[model samples]
Target: MASTTDVIAAPAPAPAKPPKRPPARKMVAWLDPLTLVKTGIRSAISATIGKQADRRLLDALAAPDVKPCDVSVDAAGRPRQELWLDYVSDLGDGWNSTYAVAETVARPSLTLRDETGATHETRGGAVLVFGGDEVYPDASLLAYEERTLHPWTCALRGQRPPPHLFAVPGNHDWYDGLVSFMRLFCQGRTLSGFETCQRRSYFAAKLPHGWWLIGTDMQLESDVDQPQVSYFQELAKQMGEEDRIILCLAEPAWLVSQVRPKEGRSYLENNLDFLEEQVFGKKVSVFLAGDLHHYRRHANPEGRQKIIAGGGGAFLHPTHLPRKEAELADGFTPRKIFPSPQESQRLCWRNLGLVVSNPRFGVLTGLLYMLLAWALSVNLGGANVPQALGLVVRTALSNPGIVLISTLVILGLMGFADRRFGRWRWLVGLLHGLLHLTAAFLIAWGVSHLMGSLVDLPFRSLGRDMLSAALIFVGGFLAGPTIMGLYLLLSLNVFGAHPNEAFSSLAIPDWKNFIRLHIDKEGHLRIFPIGLRRVPRAWKRGETAREPEWVADPRDKRATPPALIEPPIVL
Candidate 1:
């Protein structure tokens, strides 16, 4: 105060910088070596140890005894009268697909028309159900937080009267024995602007107008547990004969049972059949599920609907794969299939570019070729190409390590071969391995000849050896995946085998979809299957605080929005 001479006020502190937003997440590269190994190990553990531990200890400890929740009214205690719901599954894979679906889901309202050209407008669902596999490449706290929660949070942020959330655990969700899933979804926490209401992995909700939705937990395709049965049985006692039920499963066991009769029998008999005959009886009007990553619907003459709408951000599964039966054993045929069989078959052709689609897969194959080449130790300096290849074959057969690797490779391929192929799978897998060996041999020969002609350095010199190794690696990288792609193409198109492998390699970020349902005051349900053909790659921050923090950039060339996959279904 004494320094009155032009006392300059302290310079205003620089305006606090807005918190920098994190970089967007990319889609999972299913063919990445790390992803493959991690998922494979988790699948193995979940199938054996995790399943046992969960059944023996975890379920008993985590099972909730809370009564079924009734959502017949809003939080303000007004009668729902009518309700809307959004169902999405196999989500949490890529940022683009996840955000696209989330954006469509978060919209305040959507208007569309059915095949009859009757226009319909709907608000966002008051309740949102995650059908299954909430996170991809296995579920964990980090995976769920980053891949699932963040995208949804950014999409739904600032919304008023958030939708209630419920989920039934899928195989991936069960990988950690449902610990993270329990903490995130079963604790009644508000997640990403959604109010989670379930106190267990599976839930039952009583909607208005004598309708109920039941979600079941099928751990590793095992039978439904006793406590879950008791829970549902008790809930059923409250239902009247006029009431209709909607059954939600982690898988479509009806289709599974037809496609894979032997293994599918266990799923069908132990889960769907038991529940339908013993507990719910003939009251189930709709059966809904995910896990296949596509949309197909089968409706019986009596108007019962069986639908699989799994196109939720994961790579699309082909719908054209030949099944043992075109219709369910009970004579229910597909009324609608998205990406129709013709379109799905066309998409399968993309697998022919496997190396381009999955570069890391090519790198893994390249390293394997280099290892096999090193084991052979072929010297083609002045030798005939045929002789060099012969040497490779002999050395590969003679080396114990090489032999073991070859055997494992063949057996692994056989394991992946669809059981539909039966005994032919063994031969197919053997041929697949032999073809890879042939590719390595050819690559080795080509590299040796090329290096011999181009460089004058001694064969074993570091410079010459490094150059040769590099050439071998490059050749293997290109040829190995190309051969694999061609094999997959032929296998899927011609022999109808390796359907899962064929499409999974594509890692397609397009053809994402989800379902929206509205139960009208008249007790009629309308099903809307929404499809997004291409996800926007470029995104920009919201211009206003009321908007999501990130949104599809309108300037992006691929900014196509969601549309009806097929005409709406009213039942």
Candidate 2:
């Protein structure tokens, strides 16, 4: 026993170790109070300057002659008094929601040098048409401003502030809260988006052309109420019998076909009966509008010519081309058309349009344009032409008559509805517009299919194409000011691009981090784990995990697993 105890009791020596320091992750910093104050002040100043610049154009629009707007009933039963009309010769419609609406007006002074070493200066009048998506995917007040007001705010000013310039609400205008729009501009019921400014949806001023120029708020009941019918009725009486009427519209309602109801309407079909009944021998000299975003000239009844000048800078909506040889005539419909006696107007619609090459504001920036130009130099001229562009041209060239006719019908109806209805009503209107858009796409596709059949393959199945056609048709329906509005309210980022990239780069979620929130009836949010399956590992001892399964001795005190958790269920 003595020998065993001595052998086990042999002593051991001590060892040296390194001293410990603070953790590397815990470094903190201190900043000067003055440095922080200066930074904050600079930030506030920059923000104020930017906001002032944004509002500059709207502020400049204040005019001396354009009386403070107010809507009042008159002896003549006019809802509002006279106000000047603001017309854009060629500009596109609103921009999609979610984009910064930085509308600005820049008018620089031009210098004219004289022979005597003296210079004469003249101010140029420049008004920016901040439109690309005049009508959003949905009709909403925010969308309208996004689509129109904001982007054009600063750019709408002219040199010396033009003596008389007006801005009218477009189709998207009628879709939102007209009252709010009026309030923003300090306008009144007599002057609304649905109705022309401060007048009975009709404003007139002496134009240089000797002819009486009248601007009517034809759509009194469109989204809200369209005065189109009443406005036209009143206009007819107000105009000198010999005076030429130049109708202005955000959407050329009287110019387009039933296939593309910009304002949720269509025109007399190619249904010869409706055409003859509603459109023949009308007294319109010219109808001008700018919603379609392309440029065109149209022929109408009564020697009237319709002008489409929706060439505002924003984005391009694809235009369809038509095919005459493959024309598929349908039965005619009957309807009454204002300014026309023809009762049986056929809805013969074709597709015609041009996609302007823009340098900014979309996927095709100036750099992209230069790249494409360089690409053109490397590629042949034949290859340089856009395939999509040619497809559009082919449809237009094949059935110019149909395209023009369709455009007329749609434009006419859109104009009428926009003039008559309130913008809020456009939720329904957008559906109708989609139907027409679908028809346009089909027409273009049909022409292409027919041409393809004659050359190499058998005729394609219209049946097979039906479903996709319907989808496209429905897609067209979903696009409008209202939809765009919804996008604006819900979208997490800016316009023209997806929201993910911007937020991801910031390393920030639109909301808080991925916290699972729960709330009781009182409405305060609480965090909770959801859909958890695995039981938590237990550790009774001051350790992070349970003991390993392999233990050296079964009877040892350390053999038991640490209790990190107790009973799994919450009582």
Model 2 segments more than 4 A misplaced: 1-86, 89-147, 163-169, 184-197, 200-202, 216-228, 258-283, 300-303, 324-571
Against the correct fold, how does model 2 do in TM-score? 0.33
- Total residue pair clashes for candidate 1: 0
- Expressed as tens digits, the lDDT of each residue in 1-571 for candidate 1 is 5665767678888998654543567677777889989998988887887545655234545665636778988778888889998999899888888888887898888886555667778789988999999998888999999888988888886544578899988888988777788889988888767788788788899888888889998888556887887888888898999998888899888776544345535754567888998999988998899988888888888888999989878888888865444556455677887777788888888877888988998998888888777777767766687778677678777788888877787787767666767788778878888888888778878877887787664566787777777878888788888888888888878877777788888887788889999999998988898888888888877767677778787789866767787777888
Superposed by TM-score, candidate 2 places the C-alpha of residue 131 at a distance from the truth, in angstroms, of: 10
User: Where does candidate 2 have its weakest 10-residue lDDT segment?
Assistant: 346-355
Alpha carbon lDDT of each predicted model: 0.81, 0.30
Clash count, one per candidate: 0, 138
Query: Tens-digit lDDT track for model 2 on 1-571?
Result: 4765565655666665422311111100001224235434544553455334422223224421323222222335554222222233222222211111111112243233322445443232221221112433323466445444443332333213332323445433333323333353334232211222332222443332223344433232222122333333444554454444444554554434421433334322222222223322233444456555334444423334444544343222222211011222231122111111111011001000000111111121222222222222221112223553455456545665545644554453344233223463344344444444434444334433444445454436665344334433333333222222233222222121212111111211001000011122332222211110111111121111222111123333332211111111110
